[model samples]
Target: MDKKTILTMVLAGFLGLAQAQNNSTIAEHVKSATAISKVLGDGRKVATVILEYDAPISNRSLSPDSYEVEGKEVVGIYSNRTPETAANGTDGPYVVIEVKAEVDLDARPAPPTEAEMQEKKERDRMQGGPGLRAGWSTGGSDEYPGNAVVLQKKEIRTRTGKVYRADGNPIVTTVETCPVADRFTQEEFVSPYTGQTLPYNIFLPENYDPGKKYPLVLFIHDAGVASGPVKQPLYQGNGATSWAEPEAQARHECIVVAPEYPVITVDDNWNYSHHLDTTIALLKELQSRYSIDSKRIYTTGQSMGCMSSIVLMLKEPELFAGALLVAGKWKPELMGPLDRQNIWIISCEGDSSSNTLQGEAVAIWRQQGSDVSEATWEMTQTREELSEQADKMRAEGNHLLFTHLTGGNHRATWFVAYGIEGIQDWLFEQHR
Candidate 1:
């Protein structure tokens, strides 16, 4: 036999010997698995799957192809010591599989047929809005509720170069992963005024110190997430989570609160429910519990939540220092002296009612002796561009800034609007 063939035979013999020595199958050694997911720019995505072994596992290289996650693209595979403090391991008990995740609300396969296009057109006409997307979509929510992962039985090698066939029975399994959204502790408040209960998700900054005061962000959800599962809004968009993100916290650490209402907060006729009042009540309760900077309290929301925010601003103008209202509109006549308040209203030019009505509110504010700075920005503008526009307005000493995003639509407006750091900074700077 040739030298190469002889080498191959010897290597196969070594592998067989290694396999015989390592009698524990992979499934037998697996203790547990945790699936890790995180919020992306527009929505949340599954990011990693980690499995724990029964004993300390020697560090070894494992190809990503050894694992399969349903509907996710595996990007990396490595050994881990723990889910948290999860640095790559030298001799750890965990195996990690990282994946490229897609958002659940926007995962539809495209190249829509003519029939689908016509249906989308008809739906747009019927709904009278863009970005409705022929379904109850809000450009928010996690892509994976529970993804099935498989550890395929295959030949793998140890760091010492010993090869073994990773035998396993029933490779399909579910990993229990913790999303950052789960960080928000679930709580409820009973309003004294309305005798109503408001369920909310509150995220206190890590290492929260009561001696040091922190600002609080009140996030109201759109009609899409107004119904319960209270965490819907927390995962739906960046409204609440953006404030609590590590990067944002590194600059300005604050608390985030999101209230989920069982009923719609507001309707087209400008009517509202008692839930808004209870939301404020919940805020007051939070203030009594935590050391909150009352002057810097901010309120923000989208669609129904935005409308509810307007109502709150009008109801107790003294309560909030500023408001970030997105993709929503109020009757110009119903709009109070919102001009006097530090308000930033964002809407896409493609959103007819929101654009027109929000424009009217701006015009009304301009009429009310308020210097409002208005900007019509392109949808393609970089974050720097948006920040620059916002900076110019803030520097100009404008209380109300009206930004009309060109060529986008209602549901997608908040996803883009909330990502601008300038807006978040401006909100933090406001005081009652």
Candidate 2:
């Protein structure tokens, strides 16, 4: 072969090797596998196929408007309906793929240009909001070693509609439905007090009994998915998934209610207090509709939702038996009434933004004669360590329990906070 042809063949071989390695690494990160299935439209013809991967799929492997099934080009790709975190933490791998109408196989957009990359960096820095620091965006140039090509916030764009494959005949893959999603019933409540509507997801305990009163845990979503869509909280954060696990249900046997309100609660600052009144009304309605233990109602939230939970407690301390606030600060204005409620505060030492707030809350509770105790926790701690901490907190005879977790990132710390053993049991033990 000529010298130019020889060089071309060598480069192609190297690229193939690199791709194989990438796929291997991606597979290892997947705790469970992605479930892919065709979505048929009118006449039972293939319209789209849902791709549910346990980990984030690489943009290079599945780019918008570039996927294909049996040589039939995918017309578009959509992921807006996907939950922000899916089953994993925000930084963990959990992806949902949507394939739109079809186009010619040759119509895929070219690889992102240098100009496009630069533009996205600038936008993500300015408008990417809180979780941006988690390195969710694949940064640096493509030539940067180990820097995978992730779709930047600005690069993820697609339309939702029907488009046919070029050949009018598309092969499809099928899989079972997601069991996590199957158990939830999507619901919306209209508050008569404020006339405001709130969408929520409710998971009924498998052993639910109408005549018997069971404990209820009200979970609030953080800023990202809370406002734009109705069921965003069901996927964006760990609170929903944490409570949905069969282990949790079997242990607690309580009803779980996750409310999705309209408005970004936490961003540069936490502000769920913006719609506090409407939220209170929503809870009142839930209480009337279900057989809830009046003395065992509990509340918990992360970030923005945490801030709002504090406000909710301050205004209606008599309503909640206990609360666990994660990654949020304590507002001094509400300090006066906080001691009335049993509270567990969790924050990561690395999350400097919330450390000061947590400290202030802890001090105030102690000063007010509300029993208070402090402890350190790490995600790697064994079950024995977890139970020991729970025992110590209970012995302190304190109204407030403060835990500082190490070895966790600020954006994804909620997963670690909720995963600690005996923590939920502690919440369940409290009574008004």
Candidate 3:
């Protein structure tokens, strides 16, 4: 063959080899795209999945289109989400191209199969005994006529993790058809010493009758707030009205009596001791009218309400079963005497004042030899995590439970802490 012809043939063979290599690189890119789809079946799992291909070519070029997944019908696309060009003096036109595929998890109902049902039953059997019960009880009262008021109680189907309703009913289980009071009744009692008439809202469980005595809870609000409009002292908002009322009542089957502290700030400072005195008086009078279990009386408060709770427990430790203090500060010296009582101290990180106070109280409680459990958590801007942490704390133990929310502000933490479902659960658990 002629020299020129031989050279031409050799050049053609080299060109063909280079083209083959390019095709192999593209095939590898396709494989990577498929792997990405496998990783992101549901878009909710990840926001975006990116696949990169580095080629030897000087000019970085991406495929115009993406491969489609079969059966799943998910589409893939090349995204110039981030384009990076090579620095000067670098190889020609070389760039780094990243292709991203966005997949969203479908929101569809997943019907439980027979196997799932059997698995759930087996799981429940393995868990053994009821998970937890809410509501007040006279330590398993037998004299009280008929079945006791049972609110939130659940039989779980798993030991790992499960979501439950506010009433402690499992969401995955058969729907509970239990009946509850349509509208709670309110009763007021007047304290002659302070000339303060306190209102207590009574929640009668479904089929409630005056013939039987029921367990009771005394809820106190911070100063400057009344039970409600009209000055009905006994008509203060219980769990059923203020926030998560139904959940609170269901979890702790008791007549929650929230009394309004007089609006007067004693001596121009917040003196809760006086308000607590009136509360005790009002409670004593109610005890005479209602069959309240003196041993099971529990106290809980938020912010100023929490302050009053500490003072009340200090002043009359013998009167309460336990106390849950949220975002409130108290001197260890003042709480020293009440160390014999079960106490829970909660605070948020953002509020340095309350946080410092809470830390001091915990330290004092420890010094006094009180059994205390504390859990401090980070709070998001939305306060969702704070609520979750409070609920978890309430569920873990009813007596002496403290939950700290990280990044939470003072005001928002109080409201959320007071409204947690676990609060009532913790209160009632003391009776056990």
Best by lDDT: 1
**lDDT for 376 (candidate 1):** 83
Q: How do all the candidates rank in terms of TM-score, highest first?
A: 1, 2, 3
Between prediction 1 and prediction 3, the one with superior lDDT is 1
How large is the C-alpha RMSD of every model relative to the true structure? 10.7, 16.8, 27.3
Per-candidate TM-scores read 0.77, 0.60, 0.50
Summarize candidate 3's per-residue lDDT along 177-296 as a digit string, tens digits.
111211346566676676666555555544455676566665554332432332222211122232224444455556666554434212113343345667778778778877677778
TM-score pick, better of 2 and 3: 2
For model 2, the stretches where C-alpha displacement exceeds 4 angstroms are 1-176, 266-274, 382-388
By TM-score, is 1 or 2 better? Answer: 1
lDDT of 1 by residue, 1-432 (tens): 122322333234334533433543236556554555565435556676666666555556566576666667888777655533234555556666778764332332235567756765775676576544212333232232533455544665544555545665643334433345766888888889877677889998878999999999998877665444767776667787778776677778889998877766787767777777788778888899999999989999998878889999999989999999999989987785787789999998888999999888887877777888888877666778888877876787777888888877777677678757788888888999
- Candidate 2 per-residue C-alpha lDDT over 293-314 given as tens digits, one digit per residue, 9 for 90 to 100: 9899888888777877887887
Q: Which of the two, 1 or 3, has more TM-score? A: 1
Give lDDT per model, in order.
Answer: 0.70, 0.57, 0.44
